[model samples]
Target: MQTTCACHPLTMENRASAAIIVRLTGEYRVPHDLILTILTVMLGATALVAICHRLGLSSIVGYLATGLLLGPYLLGILHESETIHWLAELGVVLLMFTIGLEFSLPRLLASRQLVLGLGGAQVATVTLLFGAALAVAFGIDWSLAIILGGAFAMSSTAVSLKQLGEQNELATTHGRVSTAILLFQDLAAVPFLVLLPLLGEQAGGIGHVLLFTLMKAAVVFVLLAWTGRSLLPRVLHWVAESHSLELFMLTVLAMALTAASVSMLAGLSATLGAFMAGMMLGETHFRHQIEADIRPFRDLMLGIFFISIGMQLDPAVLYQQLIPILLVIISLTLIKGLVMWLLIRGFGYQKSIAARSAIVLAQGGEFGLLLVSQVISIRSDEAGLLQPVLAGLIISMLLAPLLLRNNETLANFLMHSGDKDDAKNAIDNGAQGDDDFRDHVVILGYGRLGRGIARVLIENNIETLAIDSDPRLVRELRLQGEPVLFGDASNPGLLQQARIDQARAAAITFDDFEHARRVIAQIRRFNEQLPVMLSHPADHDDCEIGDDNVIVFDSEMESALMFARQLLVVAGVETSAADLAVNSVRSHDYSELRGVGDED
Candidate 1:
């Protein structure tokens, strides 16, 4: 395959001159090295994720591991490609997008106590405590100490949320507390992002610069919010009316890229813009479909971001700075965990919930890496220490899932040793009444299609626990006393939370191909005998990897068949003849479903 790729393939000129020929034609768009790097990363990451899945590890670890192996310190397959660097930026944007999709004003208001009360305390207390320690211990400049301290105050939103989600603990009081804290950190990080660069700007008065930036950000945000309220839906409606999945996807990409560009031009991070775009659109009914379409892109880009982060870990440096790295890791986990726990306890949470949330949020988050890198860029003298600090951060994140997996045991060992665990206040992190939900159908993606399927099941007196990520939908349904929960249905953690073990069947109506694959894979793991109704979108190609493997409901094909069947009857053909004709077409399509294209 490689030889074919390198040989005289798909070009008028010989392989030796094909690249040159393309360059001569003023179409030297992408470099061959960039192409090779992308292919290498994809293949390596996929294989590693497959292995990790079998070993019950998160795919985030797999992507990071792939980066470490291919990094400059290892095989050197990916040599810090600039293209990959920028693409990694897109990963951050997508992360913000996912967060925005799940964030809504009502939910924010609902968690106001935690966000404003506990969240505000965690940041303020952690920052002051850590910053003071740094200043006193190392005699670093007070300003830089505060900067690094605030940066370190951040907990990993991606890691913590995913960890909580995987353990089926995300719906618990502790999980909500953790999520609320993370959300505050996300908001806090925005100010830090604006402040980081300004700290390096020695010319202007620092306070004045900060004020100016804040004012500009406010104006830009208000403009975008107002525009989104009036303009975005109309654009989406027009594109949606086209009935072309491709166009709909293109429209989404355009919106994200355009908003990101405008934000960058307006002096804010593209990621902040992306998040704003998502939050603005999140309130609309189109959110589920938007999330489904954006999910695949988001996942791939997020993987790439993790890989880029992994690439930053230099093994040689890690070996040389092992002692300091260990010290940093231990301090970060212990201090941050203690601070978080105390804050939660002060807020009237149970000891169990507080301790567990502390452990979960103790690690250095993905955003910390961003801050570390940013500070180092603004202060080159700190470069040497930042590298090892980053290495420690990565290690902590990789260990997060394992820590969360055994959190209950860990929490028990920490407190109330000789007592029978209090079932009332003790958060049920796993196996919460699965036996009670037996024989119920699990509907992934509680959107239009999933809801319709659920309504039908309900009509027949079947129970359903609809899992979704849209905050608005989840909030409304729960208030109306419906059995729906907000979570990423593709995640096994969410599935377990929905009590997959007791589920009799499932309807995978998610419109995104990637998420659908995840949902199907997770279902097969829990119960191979359980029936799955997967949705094949209007955009299935023969060469797509998952198409042949899973039996899915093809909406486009079924709709076409329905239209044709009724048309035949209207044209005077017998009902049975039309039915036979439709069945024959269906059979023929099914036979070729797994087949390669004619040329292949």
Candidate 2:
């Protein structure tokens, strides 16, 4: 009876095992649900990014916070693994590649003094000073200290540039200086990346490691440069001729990934290779087209990268080291600001511009995280120690947008007294006395097109008053003995300052359509009979120009006429006919053509 019971139990166990195997096979049939979940998370993250942008915060911070909230430590919607890590790494590679495309060699060469000289000095000085401080204060070894200092030496190129662009300051004196310094920081990141492996090495020979790394980097650079110069242009030209956007995009991605892999295999930073590849292609005619095409992918991947950064942050670690993190943030900001101020001032910039430049570049950058990760990879035992530094970097990045948002306010406060004096002197130096300024033409916006219009008017003996929002441009124009007001064109007070009521004709030379419309409406409200002419960029298609009360000249109209003339010339048409056609279009005489029927 005992034997019979044992045999029956064995048969039941075998049947259960067979049933379990069948269920497992069914589960492995497809992975549709896993892919759907990932897509859902990505879309949710993107939505959060948009919401954050609407709320006036950096979208990067939003994406990162979203990732953290949904990650394993929080709601557990997503889990960290090798696959996710690999995707995050790809995001970074693509980001660096896109940045490289923007970095042209000629542009760097043109600003070498400011970029390489001041920028390089700032990085070196801040690195040395902070590194020494960390070593003495925390009793840390030189290698870790150097890594920390190098991390702090970088500033967020994305944050600074975005803010400057929003304020239309990229073309201003302060913007140029900031850009030059940031460019240097970008190039300096290459060496710092190479040095990371050497820092954590057990071997005592730092020189040998560095030499090998440099040699590898040099080889990668030469390879990428040669391929880009000799082959990429032809490939792009052929792609363009075929007009296959899909093929072009695929080719770009393949090239970027291949170059990155080559750099990695060569024992160098993949970012360095990607950047070099971008720089090489930046010389081609298809650069802008490539930029436009790659933007969507870059933006998506960059968002993912930022989110991954947030998800990696352990809240427990952050909370425990809050005070120390804050201290590092403050110290890093102050030290970097001081170094930048001195460097920019040494370059002969005014105190206000220099100070602004300092504020813009005072934060830690994204590459700092990459450098720390690289270091950790080489020395796995020290991984836990990087937690505080990573926390500090995140805090600094979060604070960067806030500091930059208030840069204009800070600059104005610092330069208020000097600017007032300059304005008074400007008014005193004007040729027209307060009594002789009636019936003058008020031109809003002193940009390139506006200035050209002003010149033509001046040559015709017309007295003109120009109003521009950019303080630097206004100052320069005043120094050149021109009458320009330093204020917003849409401001009613500024219009009154320019004697708009007494002006016989007004010109809205601003490129922004909304600003032009506002200025025109305000002028009409102030002076009903003033003929207002507006300027536009070449791409603006729907410009409303009709109204007996106002005379508007859309700049696109002129560009269209010029383009037509060029096409006619290219088709072997006579120059006289082309000129006649262009003149007719410019004067709006198309209605007088013999075959043209008037629908209205």
Candidate 3:
């Protein structure tokens, strides 16, 4: 005991920690390098996103840039790790689930004209155009042409959803139309995924195999749907009654992955299965909770998915095919955007909706990437041609957000370019705002913090419009004669109803980080000049650049700094020294929260 005890102070505990680490790194063959890669990827993403935010771009762009910077095409810090791929796959699954969660049977039925009709026409038209051009112009194989064309016909769902959700435009007329078209694309992807091998083979009947797969998938879907309709709600209800959050999360994941696995076993895409699972889960009362719980996973996975996409663009290869890449990008964007615009307008939407929706859905989608990958896997001989198209598709996705961000300007230009009638609303009743609200503040979240903010505003004789998701909270607030509404601030309709455009300022005092982000984002989209205050503790790198406009009340950071200053004062530090020490702590806290500018 004496020999090992005090000589090294904590030698035994330190030895044990080292022993465990060695065991993890060496004994059981753990993926230490993979862990390192993940940490770096996150750090790199944070930095890139901070920079991109400062540049007034979406965070999705930063994730893509991170992949390119660290991928094999560049520094090669993390090269094609299977872990990253797995994360990307999970992200896609989560994305599908979210889409399903947001959309329901009733909503879908209401939008059938766009989802099935306009969406179908766009996909078919674009595929035919691209395929015919390739087969005729380049004389490529008909099979390869079909695969590539179908891929190009699809638009990036991840990019579209992120951008639209950020702007809280998913409920707008244009947003609805674009969303429906995307849903069709998601469903349409299944056939292409199955048909690639069938079309590529020289076998007796690839069609037979595809038919068999579809039959199996249909049977599986029906069975899962039936089970969902009958047993899922009860299961979720029982779990909810138990009040075990961890258990509930586990059950949700199990059900989703299980259904997805069954679908994969039945020869359909796992992503499709996840969508089905979400549809089934959407029927439960726990849908909102599930949506909230799965958000963090969805976001992390989405970042990884985007990073994987970025990794595909090798600068050298892209430069070699620069001309072809540019041609493909222009053609895809122009053709697809035009088709979407015309199709949307033909469906009775306004010219504004039609034009913006067209630009929004014009890019090559994630489903397109899926088809391209499947074809390449089945027939590697086409990789050379497919790679260039892949680059073009990714470039389009990167540009899609920018196009959407400035859609109003672009749509206005289109209106003034020749057709001014489109600029005028078909109906005056479309205006949703309260016309009399001038110099009012909009408050999101009616929690304790929100109530405080509202009270303070009212005391100052400032009018306020408040929104909260909790029905009970809204009822209570209304009984107290507070100007609070039972609405989701993340909904663009509510923001419009609150007259955000005419508001003097806005405050988001909610613990729900995701919802807060959406509220801020919607505000940004609605009135980029508006001053908004977000009452969240998270130092989200993506929102750091807008700190001035999107003010964050970081109470924790302030409290810590205060504590440090007090400690210094108590330790007999002079008043000036204490102030200096407090300032240093505050600055350090801020630096910890934000990033150093473009740290090379």
Candidate 4:
């Protein structure tokens, strides 16, 4: 029996390229150099990221470090190439697409105030202030300064949202404020990007170029939006019917890339096109599935993108201009943060909210790097300032995760505020008169279980306060006059505002055992005697809480008990007897039902 070889037969092009490949003793012609390059990057990324993970840092830090170590600056193994650049850019496009999924047109319109008002104010003021400073300090042309300023005004949407989300603070006031400003910044980056090339190519007639670009952008947006609204649903429905995962993935990629290409061809940012595509698909029923399917691609690509960013930094240049880079980083993080705080405070937000928002958005953004790169390409004379600014921005991005992780602490320290009560106060504005809700239930994790509990409690004329980390849910409930506040329930300040100490009982309705435990721990910290009830799946081993006042409700077990009770009643057993049996099982904490359906 003959075995088939998987090696590609060497043709003319292969022979030409073969000179670049190291010969190995195998019929299978593997590109050893390419494999080795990929292996080196992967191994470096894995080792550094693992260390970062162990040290409780973001993986992005590790990716950047990997690039720095392997890039031309240090090891000389990897040099910047267009292939890598294009691939890295694709990563950003996918990222923007995913973000657009979360911000549908309706949601965008709903948040017009933040997206337009606070967001508009933030972009305009930061641009003007930074532009004026650069003009005075560097004595650069006003147009160049303004271009650089627009870039500086942008905070990293990818960095801020991901870091804030991991901390479970996305629903907090600062998180909301940061998100709003970032949304507008993403929108604001498009025009700047369009103008960058025009400005670089020529010094005059920029207004005409910008106006033309905007018209093209508007046309492309409308076409994409219309396609997404009408054609996309049917196309996706057909894809789903085919029941092919590969096909589905390909289709999603096609949509994203096609949209991006169209925008790029039209002289607009590719990310804007991909983002719009995502927003369009977000309206379809397949949004969740699409998001889930695209996540792995987004994450991997985004890692590559960050690594490429790291590769761009020149260590020699960095060392030569250390002081200036340091100053730029400080101004970008500290002075920029101050500006944001003042701006947000002017919007009538609490000091804590304002301060935290400032910290969250202090760093320079990816768009800023894009602008700086353009300026460098056009004005090599300004490399002295531009290079340092670029380096400074990357360093600030590296620090962003650490800053966001401790945003609350930093906000408190910077504002000279003692507690998070102010944050709670700011979020609890909707619950104004409900502060007097004594002897009421405080429900955490207002999903199905929490809402069910609230309905029953309200039906019985008992006041109840519900805390959920879902901003949309909180908004909806608030509009309906429900005493719901958007926040992480585990925060002591939020719990305090919920009057946890004064409540008759507290319920932790989260399905995750660890998450529920955290809320319980926080509640115990404040009100040691408050009767706490937590929900968990039936298969979980018996909880070992030391507090006797705490109760555990196993959802699966409760359902089984109800089913058994109904079966008994249907079998002609007395209603009282069925109730007694169920009550007896409940009294013993369902010990007999534990591990009843084990597969082993």
Model 2 residue runs over 4 Å out of place are: 1-27, 139-141, 376-380, 412-418, 421-600
lDDT of 3: 0.75
lDDT of 1 at 69: 97
Q: Rate the local accuracy (lDDT) of all candidates.
A: 0.76, 0.74, 0.75, 0.81
Q: How accurate is candidate 1 locally (lDDT)?
A: 0.76
After superposition, the stretches of candidate 4 with alpha carbons farther than 4 Å from their true spots are: 1-29, 135-143, 241-244, 374-382, 417-574, 577-600
Over 503-557, each residue of candidate 3 has an lDDT whose tens digit, in order, gives 9999887776676777787787779888888766545554353446777777566
Candidate 2's TM-score reads 0.67
Residue range 491-585, candidate 1, lDDT tens digits: 56456656787788888777787767767777777777777777774444631534333457788668778999999999999999999988997
Please report the candidate that would top lDDT against the real structure. 4
Taking every candidate in turn, the Cα RMSD to the unseen true structure, in Å, is 10.3, 14.1, 13.3, 9.2
Candidate 3 error regions (>4 Å)? 1-32, 138-143, 161-172, 194-200, 348-353, 415-421, 424-600
TM-score per candidate, chains pooled: 0.72, 0.67, 0.67, 0.69
Clashes of each: 1, 0, 3, 0
> Candidates ranked by lDDT, best first?
4, 1, 3, 2
